[model samples]
Target: MTPSARRRVPAVHDALADLRWLINPRRRLLPRQPLTSSDHAPNRCARSSFVSETRTPGQASDYEYVCIITFIKEASTTLRRQQQLADMDEEVHGIVIVGGGICGLATALALHRKGIPSLVLEKSENLRAAGGSIGVHVNGWRALDQLGITGELRETADNVTEFHDVWQHENNKSVVVPVRGELRWVKRKDLIETMAKNIPSGAIRFGCHIADIKPANPGSHGAILTTLDGSIIRAKALIGCDGGNSVVAKYLGLSPPKSFPRLIVRGFTRYPHGHPFGPHFLRLRCNGLFVGRSPMTENLVNFFVGVWHPGGSVTKDPIAVRGLVLEKVKEQCSDEIVEMVHDVDTESLIVLTKIWYRPPWQVMFSSFRRGTATIAGDAMHVMGSYIGQGGSAAMEDAIVLARSLSRAAGSGGGGGELCEKKIGAAMAEYVRERRLRVVRLSLESFAMGMIWATKSMLAKLACQAIVAVLGTHSLGHTNYDCGRL
Candidate 1:
């Protein structure tokens, strides 16, 4: 029950497991190879020979057998930890992150705050600006607040709540919902840039795609990564924040990303005179299609249209798509909404694609982790942006993930075995706390989607009653805090 004996046993257990992995690897935990002189270092620093003090001069031959027989019973824990570390060539990193998106960068910063070294591998040459505007409610703000990057984002970000939301029912009646704490509409690029500023320079390497990942077993060596450039890197732990179409997901044998039911065409319209809507949350429904105009800066408006085109293809040409979308809106929406569409430039950039996501059934039952490789953001859980909590949930993942890992690293030993132990515990904690909340959020998101596209008069009435009475306040995930790191 002594601490030294306990430590030595775990170290020996790890050393044996690593030996098994080194020998067969395909056999999992099967033991095949025994340690050699090359596999381990001698315990030369052991307290000047305990046998020397307990015996006479003629007992030299008896020392070797005595020491070998009671090795585990006598060795100190610190010595065992040192011997475990000294057994290998020094080529492993403390942490390696896959993808350089918001969650990836935020996780790196969170680890950095705790003074942990990490390397981020991004497949792209520069920052990605794929997803459109992200609306972070109260809980999302608190997640980012923990990272300390929210203040800088506020300077250039537009408040969606300041103007109020104008909800136009299918019956041509409009209602404005008053704002409380403000929903900030920040461009995807600006938010990424803001988060990137907080990350240490050179921490991430561009164009380094992870081609293959080999995750290690518990109490074994670190994971091995083979990049597209054919470079090999070793790390104690691997975190996957590689968006929905994740390579790491494939490595872990998880389910593939599923396509959402709607066709979406989203973009920003820049007006020199601020578009005149101020902070109004502009929305309209026409012929069962959903159109939302988010209030941005004094001059910008972010808008999107969704339709039940289950098998339809989204066109690549922005002008053609915009024309098609506005034509549909013009046929069913008010003159004011049509006029707002007119202000949008045909050549402006837009995102036109199906939102591929995992269903609640899949996410609820899927494993968020396997060995040292675990995921966050769109990779781990993907849902519609109807609730606008995607960004906040990603931030929370980074915080919780980092918090778990940091706690593990601080618990006594600091070798590969210790790292393996810590990472497993940390990922378990992250998954245990985050899974249910995301499931509820995904349910809330699905409900919103169903309500938005419903054209039946009775269904619309029910939707209105449910929304007016419950809103999003009753949903459980939105109230999460992610606690302190």
Candidate 2:
């Protein structure tokens, strides 16, 4: 047996033994009668009666199998009723998710798992993920496990085992901080396509822009979503998984506090044959500027090079922007790195220029509960990409929300006893519990970006020294407790 299986055998045997004692009539200290289909039909034989009649000489030796099968059928019937009630009580027939990104797709998948149907609305006619590769850590993978979507993500991702390689550009001196656990990296597009493929064909409604949203009924608590085409979709709830430029945020009148001090330039390119780094480790150059490299696929490496350009100076010229980014990368990198950036087909490179924001963590939990709406991921808390938590956190939110909603709906609590009040209370509870952890992560991401962007020689030296000493210690710990709900 494998080591893990061997270790678990004792616990498994103990559990079976305890179960046997509980079920055995002579050994049971508590009541020990076989459950019947109905008390009124006492004359009717129980399902177990058939088990005894159909059993062969050898089959009668295993009472556990009979009991387990009977119990499962009964339990399945009960669960079916719960699911029916959840569907009957659903306040919204259609759901409109604003963003077409990873978080938006994940939320849709979570809702679909509960058999709660939704419509994912994207403004773009064709699906396109924001450029750059993303890392899905252990906690993120756990959340995906709950959604039954991890396998899909795994198929398209490059499995990784380390945080990053820290190097000084001038000296080329580097040290590796081993990550405590494994992680997966994928092009943002791969994740999006995986999620989109799993959803029902008609589930995601693309080319639909949301212009305004307001309460459909002032006191009744339904919402009306005004689309760019001037059509209106009235839903029980609206989820603003929309990105930083989210119109939903604007419509809701929740002005997010600005947090991005620099314009971020990100994209992917093929590394040359003699590239300095390998696929297993992520490499970061920490000079006056910060550039990162990681495997997007077997042949391509995703690199993000950033500098502190004021928001207003970030115009729409992709060529000019690309040149400026290449120039900054050249300032701190060697010839090979420069050649990789230069070799990138300018037409294929994706460039995004925007000021980042870190919304109050409390916003994510609070926004959706108030008016048939809630926000998740970047829409709720926009932070720099330094910590690689944006997509993971969003997926986590979807998992928790799905499980909570499923339980509430399946228990016959959805429409009758469940009521809007109970639903609101549950949503509020989710927000309260999740805010602290996501907030801490947002703050950590912001701090990392600041430290990486420090330009003063003294400050940079001090920051590097601190990281060299404490960075490994802070590498791979994240709070992932979606199972609590």
Candidate 3:
């Protein structure tokens, strides 16, 4: 068969199944109910009037016949081509990872590197390349190195050499600390696209929204995931790389991530000619407001502002988000910083979020794995970016998780059916290895957040003690590596 014909065969086969759903009476009526809502009532009435005026009852029957005939002809063609395509793909996969963000793709790539294939299910139709840049520290870089994309990423991002903190409440005190290890801010798009490019084609399936997940049966060896479209997927192992709102994590009986009463606005500013700021990562803290500026490249800078808002709510309007950031930073930041905020590209105002994290205690005790299913990244230990390890930590989770699973699958030999008992043990080990590391990060980040957000001096002192005991210094957490994948 010609290559073009082979490609058309699968497309037609998939289309036939999709058409079956489209032809269902129940499915056809499902969307019409929304049109009857109060907000759409007038439009619905107008549409009804037009239809009634355009067709008599006899003409309506003829119109329906035309539609039905066309649908039948297309479905017949789909079935004939489907047979010629000889598609016999299995409904079951060895490993299925939910969410195709940074963590999900990294986990898939890590498994690919170890010769264990994984299927990534992303709800979005395409890569979610939206959002601001992420800071990758030394530990994160190590994970990337194992995944074999460090060299490519370095070309797009420059390392952050120093941290410059300016305390406005402390009489404008300035402290400069040199970074001991690697730190670079790469655009979310760059990291995601680069990682995606290395992954095998057809490994990541888009537009697959998971509605429910359950064990195949009591004492079952694998998991059954139900997509919103009513299709079922069976997997020998399931990994959840979905973010803070992960449904897979919920299935593991983990508590939802707790929120901080703060609104963070992250935006990028561009200098077409050149930027004046050098390589230093700058931060300004005053009262309950915090601002950070990091250069991603020679002409582009990424900055964020955090305000201790009582309610963690921000308008979705881009203009309003930029204005709010400016309002919070103007009290303490320099005029140069203010100009940068004002000049921020309106389109780049993508991250206006209420910070959320799992408390350290929760991290220490939570059950991140159940049976053959487990979770990683934010789904396992979502933490605030106070320590700037959220992205990196997720990457670490990917490497460790893939490493653990590979060992288990390899023990039963490189190929053939996966052993569920071994897979569960590997998941437990991954959780055990990552628990303490992420707990420490959660503790330090929580303390730093308390110290910055608290108004009472007594409370601030208490948080300070927590920070002291944890020995949480800048660039300290970046030392440990997740080891080779």
Worst 10 residues of 1 by lDDT: 52-61
Comparing 1 and 2 on lDDT, the stronger one: 1
So what's the TM-score on candidate 1? 0.74
CA lDDT of every candidate? 0.71, 0.65, 0.83
Candidate 3 lDDT, 143-174, residue by residue in tens: 99999999989999888999998888999999
Q: How would you encode candidate 1's per-residue C-alpha lDDT over 1-485 as one tens digit per residue?
A: 36676465643544444444444546644434433222222333233323323322222223334434355455666687777775453346768889999889888988887767788889999887565677776677787788888888787767765333334454666556555565778878888887777788988889988888886645564677888777777877888889888887777678897765676677777878657777777666556577788777887778887766646566767677667777888887777677766767554456546666677777899888777778888888877777678888898999888888888888838642236666777888899998987877666665566565556778767655654554653333556688887
Ranking by TM-score: 3, 1, 2
Q: How many clashing pairs per prediction, in order?
A: 3, 3, 0
lDDT string for model 2 (284-351, tens) is: 66555666666656667666666665446566576777788788777777776687678775655666
| Superposed model 1: Cα runs more than 4 Å off | 1-91, 162-169, 217-221, 345-348, 415-418, 450-477
Clashing residue pairs in candidate 2 (N, C-alpha, C atoms within 3 angstroms): 368-373, 368-374, 413-418
Error of 1 at 305 (Å): 1.8
The prediction achieving the highest TM-score against the true structure is: 3
